[model samples]
Target: MPLLAFWESNPDEVSQTSIEQIVAMAGDGNLRDGSLCSDELRQYLTQSDTSKLASYVEHCLSNSFAKGGQVLQDLVNELGRRLDFKVANGRYQGTVNAIGFDGIWLSPEGHTIVAEVKTTDAYRIPLDTIASYRRKLLDSAEIAEPSSILVLVGRQDTGELEAQIRGSRHAWDIRVISVDSLLKLIQLKENSDDSETGRKIRSLLTPMEFTRLDSLVDVMFTTATDVEATIIHSAAEKAETSDVITSKETSTTPSGWEFTDATVLDAKRVKAIEALAKQLGTKFIKKSRALYWDSSHETRVACSVSKRYTKGSYPYWYAYHPQWDEFLGEGSRSFFVLGCMDLNFAYAIPLDILRKNLSALNTTTTERSTYWHIHLSETSNGLIALQLPKSSRQLPLDDFRVPLDQS
Candidate 1:
């Protein structure tokens, strides 16, 4: 069976398998460019989550296997794609007439990086050959003059390679980083909510003079601040929408309205989202604290969790942010999924219908954000319904209840 097919059939076994074992199971056990094995492996990598990618990278670097070097090359290019770069995979074998680069990564801002992957820097690198590839690309206009070379080595101990690059003429145009650092970047980007932080992470790859430490410090500071803000917003009862951008009239939560503290409901949020994913029949990738998208980015969902209040007829309350509106707008199919009480019961409201009646909902405004308040309760007919503010008619929600079944 092909590696991907086998993985789908035997996820637990494949999850415990090493890179060598996986390669052995793949078609022909060969990973040359354009081969069936290579195609299957790359497809498998793309479909796998970030954590799986990190594990595969570790296996490739730690164990020796047939065609391991070529596998590492493909892994590095996949890392490039995860970093939001437009990646073009280079050939497995270099020919005299052809450029021998491992990959070409194009940034959104038009900068180019010719990437090379090496398991070790113990042997002296041919800086001239790597530079020549860049030159050829520049001459053919395949890459612009602002292009540079990046060498991703397997080990963090690159003292020998560092000295070699410093002494070489290509030192100004070449930068070296360990695969470990690259994986951390992927993890960081996946966890972060700020898009600017992603831009800064990409900037670290661009060839630059690091003699002055200000730019590096700025990147660190920005990343730390954004991560801290995300944590605070997730935990705060009346939190600012730190990840959102808004410009609107400030309002306050209505008196007697219930507030769902995120900290109290966070544990249930994960299972709720998982249930919603199953209901929608899509594998969703986390984008922020409450936002997710499918692999194709075609479907988006913002899931909120609330504890059921004992005192009120409308027992559940959830805050809906403008940021979620913007997020859902980008998707062809979007939903605001609300999990109440034990979370066995939930409503997946269509964004279009919810958006049309947003004006009828009450608002809670903090210094940094203004969000709508959603209330849910059981009607006299024992059906789920959305209780609108200002005595507006309760909207029937029975049609939108998401089934929380293992099936």
Candidate 2:
């Protein structure tokens, strides 16, 4: 029968046939010599697309096999003959009709090894699943120890064979081989065409199937292993500091200011501002609720500070009443600094001198330079400084000072 015919009929049966063929081929010394089967069926299962056997096999062979089902059947038959293994189609085991591994293996040492095979992704196989298979084999009263092996056959950029043994209790050895290797072997046999056996073995090998098998193996093993440690570490480092303030907040407002009721600030906004501040080399203070540059010449700024109503509803008139009035009306004395702005200067300027200048500006109506008004609003929670117009004359002395001209 053609290999395509068996593949189209049923995946389970196709697998069994292929295993038988491989065993025979090995026995004939056409493939490789080994005392026991190399569990190639498991590898085939991992590499084969069993969901739609006909289409998968067709795809693997690039539709070269005219009769899809027959091609698979023929391949398996040839493999069995070449490996010198007895091939059986459907073997019954109690309630289950084991299509994949119904055939009995007659070892050279007179040991009969019964095997079950599946083609699937490597990572998807759970330890529990392997345990279940072990239990099923034991329950069936098949050969002792069962000698189960899992084959993970996939492709890599470069064709190279790799193997690893896995399994906890029973210790099932796993071998990972590249599909290229199998294809190469088949190619070699085909090229020789020395005998009928050679032609049959060569006909079963296809490059496309080897490529598909490679993809399956890659996905499986890659997923099964632990990866992404570097990414995790990078993310962890960034999240360590919680209280860093940022530059955006400082740039948004004028200097030496502290905000009261800062808790009202959105968490995301605060984080963004903190990040900005770090980049700008500005100072961020949680206690003062302010962002400022370390240099005395820089201005400080703060955000939020209103005495608004609490988030929830309050009693009767209290709901309509301003929270500040309500608290004060109730004889509660609470003072909050909404926000404060301070000028940071390279040279210290006395607060007394600043106050004198402020008083002179308030009293004088004579012609003066750019006049500016610095308005500060007081709230129950804190003081808030309103933004001053550019024309407003409340310029800090530091703005007017300059070092000696270099020219």
Candidate 3:
């Protein structure tokens, strides 16, 4: 069976499988520079969640195998993809004619990073050779001048390698980062809502003079602040109430549902994705906190979860942000999935339909942000509808309800 099929069959053993074990299940039990096994492994990595990727990285770093370094190289490239870079995978092994870089990551702002993966810093690296690869890429116009070399080491204690780079003539053009730090950056990017967070993470890979620590501190502080804000917003959402105008032209304020648990919103959001993934017959890898996409990049979904409000005609409320809209635009087929936690159902609204009704939706604008308010109400006849502005007609959500049961 293929790697994905094998993984599907043995889901529990995937994390425990070593590099060699995974290779044996691929093409001919061998991993070459441009072989079928390499292709299969990379595809699997692209579709894997961050947890699986972290596990595989641990397997690679625990003990060296026949093709362990190559595996690490591919994982690092996938990390680049998660960080919103346009990644071009490099060779597993260097050749005489081609550049010996492991990967090239192109940022949205037009900067480039030439990546090199190392299992450890026991031996000194040939910084000149890595620099020469960058020069060759620049000469051939494969990468522009604003490119720098990144050495990804397995060990967090890279003292020797740090000394070597600091002493070398090419020190200004090369930077070093541990595999642990790289993975942490990926986690931060995956959870962040700020659009500029990815750019700042990419900036950490480039060569920068750290004589003054203000710039570095700014990146860390801003990212942490944004994450904290997201947490606070989620907590505040549970207690917030809004007036829902009924069909009879009467406005009534709803009380927030009394709930003791903190993780229910998160759980419902996860279930929404799981239920949609089964219905679509394809696995979706998370691209961001709210956005997920299939391996083929053809389908994307932005999932938002809402708690049930008490004593109102409309019991569910969701804040749809611009970032989710932008993320859904990256795919050919996209959906804005709203999970009503109490109703135990979600509406996977097509992007085109959502776009058409956006102007008729109610929006809440503040100094920091603006978002459309999505409200779901049930009728006396046991039907759900999307509540729109009083000027527009409400939309029935029964047809757009995502499949919640396996059958």
Best by TM-score: 3
List TM-score per model, in order. 0.80, 0.24, 0.90
For lDDT, candidate 2 versus 3, the one ahead is 3
In candidate 2, where is summed lDDT lowest over 10 consecutive residues?
312-321
List of clashing residue pairs for candidate 1: none
Better of 1 and 2 by TM-score: 1
Please give the lDDT score for candidate 1: 0.78
Query: Residue by residue across 1-407, what tens digits does model 3's lDDT show?
Result: 88878887676687577667887887777888879898888888887888788888898899768888888889889888888788999998777898888999998988899988898999989998899999999999999968898999988989999999999998998999999999999888877777778788889989988999988998898788788767656645554564322332222236432342336655677788878887777778877778889878789998887666665556877788888888788789898999876666788999989888888898877555888888888877888888887556788888888766555
What are the root-mean-square deviations of the candidates from the true structure over C-alphas?
A: 6.6, 31.1, 4.9
Per-residue lDDT of candidate 2, residues 12-123 (tens digit): 6655543335334332312221222223422333234222233343343443432333333333332322222333322222234442343343332333333322222343
lDDT of each: 0.78, 0.30, 0.81
Clashing residue pairs in all predictions, respectively, total 0, 67, 0
Off by over 4 Å in 3: 8-17, 235-239, 242-262, 405-407
For this target, which candidate reaches the highest lDDT against the unseen true structure? 3
Question: Alpha carbon lDDT of residue 363, candidate 1?
Answer: 88
Q: Is candidate 1 or candidate 3 better by lDDT?
A: 3
TM-score of 2: 0.24
Best to worst by TM-score, what's the order?
A: 3, 1, 2
